[model samples]
Target chain A: MNITAKAHEDLILVTVGEDRIDAACAIQFKERMRELTQAPSSRVILDLSTVAFLDSSGLGAVVAVMKLLGPDRKLELSGLTPTVAKVFHLTRMDTVFTIHPSLPDGLQKAG
Target chain B: MELVFDSNLDAVRGGLADLLDSGPLCAMEADARGTAEIVLAEVFNNVVEHAYATRQGRIKVCLKNHPDGVLVTVIDSGSPFPQQQLPQGLLPEINAWDDLPEGGFGWYLIRSQVRHLSYQREGKHNRLTFCLPY
Candidate 1:
C-alpha cells in the first residue's frame, strides 16, 4: 500500500514500499500510481528494491502504469528481486521496459 | 495441514504466506519457494476474484508435503473455472512496448513453473492441484 514517488533529474522514480504486489494490493497499487503520476514527467522509473514478491496482478499493475505513461514518456525499472525479475523475464516483459540491477545502474543506462 | 480460508482477497494471500512460513518447503532449490508463493497466490486470488465474485464463500486449502515437492489442493465451493478449457503453453507475444499485455499472465506463469498442475470440478466444489517439485 506504500508507493513512494521522487524525481531524479529527468526521471521520476516511484518506489514500491511493500514486499508484495499481489491481489491484496494490486488494485490499490494501480489507483495509487494514477495519483502518483498526476504531476507528469517525460521519463519514469519504478523502484522495486523493497518489493520481495510479485504476482500477475502485481505485474498487471506495473503494465497499467506503463500504459498510463503513454508513448511519449517511458517507464524504466530498477532493483528487481530475482523472483520479480524472473516474472519480467518469463513474461518477456523485460524487453518491454529498461531494467537495471540498481538505481545507479538505471541512471547510468538512462544517460 | 488444511485451512478453510475466508473468501476475502487479503485472507487468501496472507493465509498461504502463513502456511508456507510454517514449513521449509519454501526453502527448496533456487527460486522454488518464490515460484510456489507466486503460483499459490495467483490461484487463490483467482478463486476470490472470479469464483467467489461479489459473494463470500468457503475455500479449503490442503497442504501435503511430499518427498519431491509440496502438493497444494485448493477446494472451493463457488463457481467452477469460467474458462471452458485452460489454454495450453500460452506464451503471450510482447514484441514491443505497445504489445505488452496487462492481464491473463497468471495461469501461464503458474503452469510454466509448476508440475502436475491439474483441475477438476466435483459437483459444487472446484478442485485445483499442483506441485512445487524442486
Candidate 2:
C-alpha cells in the first residue's frame, strides 16, 4: 500500500509504489487512499505503472476509493499494467472510469 | 507441484509467491503468468474468507502441467458451498457510480480466467478444480 501523493495545480497525482495489491493489503490500500485524498482536489489521478498484479479485492478497493471521492470529484487511473487492465476489462469496469495510457505530459516529468 | 499453507490472506500472498516463483508456473510467459496469479489469488482468498470464516485451517493446492494448460486443485477442510455448488458467476450489474459494486467480482474473475471449473465435497474437505490455459 505504498503510495505517494503530489499536488499538481488542479489535481492530485497519486502513484502506487507497490508491485502487487491483493487480498493481503486491499483494506489498507483503501484506508490510505482515504487519508491521502482528504485534501480538496477536483480530480485525482492514480498511477498504477508499478503495480504488476491486482486481484478482485484490489479492484474493489479502487472502486471504493472512487465512490469515496463522490459525485463532485473524479478518480482517474493511469499506467494500468496488462494484468490490472484485464481485471477491469473482464468486469467491464473499464467503462466506469476514465483510463489514461500514462500520466499527462506535465506530470510525467514529476516522477 | 503442490503447496500447503495456512488459511489466511497474508499467507495466501506468500503461497502465491512461492507457487509462481518455482515449478512450472515459473516458466510461463509473462502474460500467462500474470493471469495465473490473478485467478489463483481469487480462488485461494475465497476459501480463506468464505470457507474458513472465523476459524483456522490449512489449504492444499496441487498443480499439474498438461500439454494444453496447467490443472489446479485446491483442497480445504472448511465449510462447503452454500448448496454444495458453485456460483453462477454472472457479472455484477454496473449501476450508478455511487452504487458501483465493491465486491462480488471474485467468482466472476475466477470463472472467466479458468476452464472446466468443478467443485466437490468429499468427506470433510472441499475440493475445487480448474484449468488455466497457457
Candidate 3:
C-alpha cells in the first residue's frame, strides 16, 4: 500500500507504488488513501499504473475510499493495467468513476 | 499443478503468485491467464475468509488441463457452507452513491469467468471445482 500524493493545481495525484493490492493489504490501502487524501482537493486521481493486480477486496477498498471522499470531492483513476482493468470492468465499477487512459498531459511530467 | 498452503492472506498471495508463474498457467494467453488468476484469487480468498473464519486450516488447489479449459479443484478442511449450498452471486444492484457496494464481488467475479462450478462437503472437507476457459 505504498502511495505518494502530490498536489498539482486543484487536484491531488496519488500514485500507488505497489504491484498488487489484494486481501492482504486492502485495509492498509484504504487507510493510506485516507491519509493521503486529507488535503482539500476537489479531484483525486489514483494512478494505478504500477498496480498489476487487484482483487475484490482491493476493489472494495477503492470504493470505500470514494465513499469517504463524499459528494463534493471526486476519486478518479488513471493507467489501469490489463488485469486490474478486468476487475473494474467485470464489476461494472468502470462506469461509476471517471477513468483516464494515463495521467493528464501537464501532470504526466510531474508524476 | 497442485499446491497446499496454510489458510492465511499472505500465503494466499504467495501461492497465487507461484501458481500463476509455473507450468501451464504461465504459458496461457495473457487474457486467459489474467482471468485464471482473478478467478483463483477470489475462490481461494473466499475459502480463507469464510471456510476457516474462526480457526486454522489448510487449503489444497489442484489444476489440470481440460479439453475446453483448465480444471481447478480446491479442497479445505474447514466449515461447510451454510445449508450446504453455494451462493447465487447475483451482481449487487448499483443504486445511489450512498448505497454503493464496498464488497460482495468475489463470487460474481468467479462465476463470471469460470464454468462447471460445483461444490461438495465431503465429510469435514469442502471441495469446490470450476473450469477456466481459454
TM-score to true structure, per model: 0.90, 0.97, 0.98
Q: Is the docking of candidate 2 incorrect, acceptable, medium or high quality?
A: high
**TM-score of structure candidate 3:** 0.98
Residue-wise C-alpha lDDT for candidate 3, range B1-134, written one tens digit per residue: 99999899999998998989997788799999999999999998999999999998999999899987988999999999999998888888787887899999999999888999999999999999999997
Q: What's the i-RMS for candidate 1 in angstroms?
A: 1.2
RMSD (Cα, Å) for all candidates, in order, is: 2.9, 1.0, 0.8
Q: Could you give candidate 2's per-residue lDDT for residues A1-111 as a string of tens digits?
A: 589899998899999999988888999999999999999999999999999999999999999999999999999999999999999999999999999999988999595
User: Against the true structure, candidate 3 has what lDDT?
Assistant: 0.93
Question: Which structure is stronger by TM-score: 1 or 3?
Answer: 3
Candidate 2, position A45, lDDT:
98
- For model 1, fnat equals 0.79
Query: Candidate 3 lDDT, tens digit per residue, A1-111?
Result: 579999998899999999999999999999999999998999999999999999999999999999999989999999999999999999999999999999988889596
lDDT of 2 by residue, B8-122 (tens): 9989989999999998899899888988998999999999999999799999999999777889999999999999999888899999878999999999989988888999999
* Residue pairs of candidate 3 with colliding backbone atoms: none
lDDT for predicted candidate 2 compared with the true structure: 0.93
Which runs of model 1 end up more than 4 angstroms from their true locations?
Answer: A105-111, B24-30, B83-89
Per-residue lDDT value at B134 in model 2: 91
Which rank order by DockQ, best down to worst? 3, 2, 1
DockQ for every prediction shown? 0.74, 0.89, 0.90
Chain B TM, per prediction: 0.87, 0.97, 0.97
